[model samples]
Target: MHEMSITQGIIDICEQHAGGRRVLSLDVEIGELSSVVPDAVEFCFEACSRGTLLEGARLNILRIPGRGHCLDCGTDTPLTAAFGSCSRCGGYRVTIETGEEMRVREIEVDE
Candidate 1:
């Protein structure tokens, strides 16, 4: 899957910031609506990190819940999918507030 490439990207970011230091752990954020599977990423991390600074690094995945604001009902509700209906009025006019993010949040490196 694409997680291999994504894992490589994570390693690249860690190496860039680690400055040749060995990475001990990493914190990554994955949104519910982002469609990037955390398990897949975790599975790929080991294979992708081999021979890199993140080889033995522990990966911590933070799952973000999806949220949306309904324009018709003026209500904020939890969303489970990309094109989800509003909970209040069951309206389709909804704007996403969060849960579309995928990024590396923190990195711990060995001194």
Candidate 2:
């Protein structure tokens, strides 16, 4: 899955940003459309973080909702998944508003 690569990237960032500190916990924000599988990422972290500063680091994932905007109704409405459907009006040209991001929101390190 893509999360494996993503997790590797996160570990790299942590290693670079941790600056020789031991990682205690990592909080990541994953959107619905991020295409990341939490279980797979967690499983891979155990192997990817071996011998690294984040060997025993805890990974916390926060899931974000996918939102879309209705073009016909001119309203920023929230829809399910990637389907761009308007709620107020019968339109299929709704634009996405959120749930397309993957970022490291916070990190805890030991002093």
2-95 in candidate 1: lDDT tens per residue? 8888878888998999999999999999999998999999999978898998988999999999999999989998999999999989998989
Q: Model 2 off-target regions past 4 Å?
A: none
Candidate 2 at 7: error in angstroms?
Answer: 0.9
Lowest summed lDDT over 10 consecutive residues: which window, candidate 1? 1-10
lDDT of 1: 0.93
Candidate 1 TM-score over all chains jointly:
0.96
Model 1: colliding residue pairs: none
* Model 1 bad stretches (over 4 Å): none
Kindly list the per-residue Cα lDDT of model 2 for residues 1-111, writing each as its tens digit: 777889899999888889999999999888886678778888999999999999999999888888887877788776666775777786888888788778888889999
Candidate 1: count the clashes: 0
**Per-residue lDDT for 105 in model 2?**
86
